[model samples]
Target: MTKKNWNINLKEMVKVGVHFGHETKKWNPKMAPYIFKERQNSHIINLTYTARFLSEACDFVFDGAKRGKQFMIVGTKHQTADAAKLAALAARCHYVNKKWLAGMLTNWFTTEARLEKLKNLMKKKNTGGFDQFTKKEAAILRRELNKLQEDLGGIRYMKKLPDIVIILDQKGEYTAIRECRTLGIPTICLVDTDCDPDLVDIPIPANDDGRGPIRLILKKLILAIRTGRAL
Candidate 1:
């Protein structure tokens, strides 16, 4: 891949185990079309379509970046948490690495209040207001800060709803997808054979639980976003 152009071939994709899908029994009926065939009782995804869909999704993300659209990345799974944070940070977008707070985007006003409280707690701690208070008061502030950080640390700067959402595990994070659909936010997701591809605007059929593939795909998205920054 060149600096100005980024593309991965079949060999690289195969080396990353992108073609592997869920077992035939666990496969979703809607994903039948994307399945090339059943091999060893498991569905083999059509890498041809995976590449095509990935390219299209990259175009969408890149264009969104050029237009200065905000995107939120959701990846709370063990396999994808680090990749999600890295990708979102690289793209300068919000991420949900821990918990996808309910109504985070759809009902942001109420959510903002919670975020504000978290901010106030941090301010009190930084200002040493707890110094004059009792130990109980100091302990309360500490507990609140830790809880809020675990809940909303990755999304502290999400001042408003995102224009698009990029997710790692569609099936595992279906609630995130559902909220996006309800709010009319377009989504791009990695859909395993068990997931419904129709849930996302762009679905890349790949192993959503693998580190290598998730890393590669997220890298591609980061590259696309960075490239758009130049425009």
Candidate 2:
């Protein structure tokens, strides 16, 4: 394995509140190893450990991408959704920012069917295929197409289950994590102090709720992925 230098900056992470974790009362005991100290009733994530773990995760993602492994970025929460989509787009990876359908990965056949439907609807609408229908019918079709696009747009091009999944919120995306686990897919997740670190294959302990932290972390990961793909 080659040595890779990471772009994760410890001082920058602290400035963006990435060191901040959930309140002490809400913290999971499993997160003790990553907690630096308690300040103002909240846990402070140990930046040293955060940086180390994040670098390892980035390295893994980069190497995987270099080998043409597919990734799915999952973050449906309001704070992280947009960031997730943008990062995935930048990295050319699949994403699920709007919602996580229960059988998204475990039920590949159904998900593929929905994706095929979405593709057909989009193609028809783009090439004037909708002109054959009456105005009212076209309107109905357009609405359904829009709904499908909003729900499955990110993964429409994904022909199979992803080799890896990057989850933004461990607690909010518990179902997604479980689905990945059930399918034996590896997961790299941003876990707050209140989240179970053991649930993910690679847990990056940080503030999962803040937009700054979320964007910062995703940005780094995307850069690594892009670098890998470019190579």
TM-scores for every predicted model? 0.94, 0.97
| Worst window of 10 by summed lDDT in candidate 1 | 1-10
Alpha carbon deviation, residue 58, candidate 2 (Å): 0.7
Q: The CA-based lDDT of model 2 is what?
A: 0.92
Superposed model 1: Cα runs more than 4 Å off: 1-5
**Residue range 144-169, candidate 2, lDDT tens digits:** 99999998999988988999999999
Structural RMSD, model 1: 2.5
Put down candidate 1 lDDT per residue, 1-231, tens digits, no spaces.
Answer: 123335957778899999999899999999988899999999999998888888888888888888898888899999999999988888888899887777777787988887888888878888987788789988887898899978888878778888989999997888899899998999999999999998889999999989999998888888888788778
Which 10 consecutive positions of candidate 2 have the poorest summed lDDT? 1-10
| Model 1 TM-score (2 dp) | 0.94
lDDT (0-100) at residue 163 of candidate 2? Answer: 97
Best by lDDT: 2
